[model samples]
Target: MWAELIQEVRVAQTGVQILFGFLLTVVFQPKYGRLADTDQAIYIVTVVMGACATGALVGPVSLHRLVSGHRVKPRAVRLASRMTLVGLALLLATMTSSLLLILRVATHDGYVPYLVTAVVAWYVLCWYALPLWARRRNRGGSGD
Candidate 1:
């Protein structure tokens, strides 16, 4: 369980690290200054979310390191799993906000919000719904 959790965290950690690194550089770009106040606010929120996601995704490794010698593998695995979930959620928010900001700046279309909504729904379905559905569908029959 711990190994599986670590693998999952590794994937999320890499993605969030890349995103946070990119977000950190955005502020120094000359075009950043030309953004409208609302866009600027969105950028700030997105950056913060990216930071949080990075931390949550990276937390499992730190947690494991600190608790390694305590003979608490089960507890550590549970906590790591929770952190990964939070990280994924934060990643979702960060992506949504980033998309919103990009679309708003690229094209001030009235359909921006609707499009973002559709994409978010798709993300939720892909990231969470399918796995949950699979679990529920196979729960009893597998006899694990």
Candidate 2:
């Protein structure tokens, strides 16, 4: 379970790191100064969330390194799993906010909120709903 969790964290960490890096650069872009106050606020929130997601996703590695030989593998794994889940939730928020900012800046359409809402629903379905459904369905199945 520890190995599997680390593998999963690696994938999420890569994605969040890339996103946080990109968010860092966005502030240096000239167009950033032209953004409205509300848009800038959203950008700030998105960047902060991306940073947090990156930290959470990367936490398992640090946890493992610090706790190696501490005889706390089970406890460490449980904590790391919780961090990963929080990271994923933060990632979802970052992506949603980033999408909202992009759509608002690109189209300036009233439908942007609706579109963002739909995309959030899709993310929730893909990220949370299906896995939970499968877990519940297999609760009484074979040990495999």
Candidate 3:
């Protein structure tokens, strides 16, 4: 479980770091000055979310380093797994809003909201629902 959790965190950590890096550069772009205040606010929130996701996803690495000799590997692994899951959730929100803001800016069409919502729903189903259902079904069939 620990190895699996670490591997998952590594994948999420790379994605969050890349997203956060891109968000950090937005303020310096020339076009940033022309955005409306509301857009700017959304950008800020999105960046914050990215940062938090990065922290949560990377937290397991720090946890392992700090507790390498504490004889709490199982507990630490479980906690780290929870953190990674939370990070993924935060990341989903950030990416969804970021896409919404970008598409709203680029297209300015009435369908942007619907498109964004659809994408968000897709993310939810792919990232969470399928795995949860499979877990429940597998567990229930174990005859415990």
Candidate 4:
């Protein structure tokens, strides 16, 4: 379970790190200074969320390294799993905010919020709903 969790974290960590790195560069862009106050605020929030998501996704490796000699694999796995879940949720927020900022800057259409909301719903369905449904459905079977 620990190995599996680490493998999963590796995938998430790569994505969040890439996103955070990109977010770090946006402040240096020429258009950054021209953004509206509200848009700047959104950008700040998105970057912060990206940073946090990156940290959370990378936390498992750090946790393992620091506690390597200890006999706490089970507890560590539980904690790391929780951290990964939080990281994923933060990643979702970061992506949503990033999209919102991009859409707000690209076009001032009134339907942007609706479009973002729909995308969020789709993410929730894919990231959480389906997995949860499958977990519940298979709870009584031998899969566990």
TM-score of each: 0.96, 0.97, 0.94, 0.97
- Tally clashing residue pairs in candidate 1: 0
Residue by residue across 1-144, what tens digits does model 1's lDDT show?
888889989988888898889989989999999999999999999999999999999999999999998999999999999999999999999999999998999999899999999999999999999989988999878643
Better of 2 and 3 by TM-score: 2
lDDT scores for all predictions?
0.93, 0.96, 0.90, 0.95
Q: Which ten residues in a row have the lowest lDDT in candidate 4?
A: 135-144
What tens-digit string does per-residue lDDT give for candidate 4 at 1-144? 988999999998988898889989999999999999999999999999998999899999999998888999989999999999999999999999999999999999999999999999999999999999999999988865
Count of residue pairs whose backbone atoms collide, per candidate: 0, 0, 0, 0
Q: Which scores higher on lDDT, 1 or 4?
A: 4
C-alpha root-mean-square deviation, each candidate: 1.2, 0.9, 1.9, 0.9
Please provide, for model 2 over 79-110, each residue's C-alpha lDDT reduced to its tens digit, 9 standing for 90 to 100: 99999999999999999999999999999879
**Candidate 1: worst-modelled 10 consecutive residues by lDDT:** 135-144
Model 2 error, position 112 (Å): 0.6
The TM-score measured for candidate 4 stands at 0.97
Model 1 scores a TM of: 0.96
Which TM-score value belongs to model 3?
0.94
Per-residue lDDT tens digits for candidate 3, residues 4-104, read: 78998898888889989998999999999999888898898999999899889999999999999999998998899899989999999889878987987
Q: Identify the leading candidate in terms of TM-score.
A: 2
Q: If the candidates were sorted by their lDDT against the true structure, best first, what order would they fall in? A: 2, 4, 1, 3
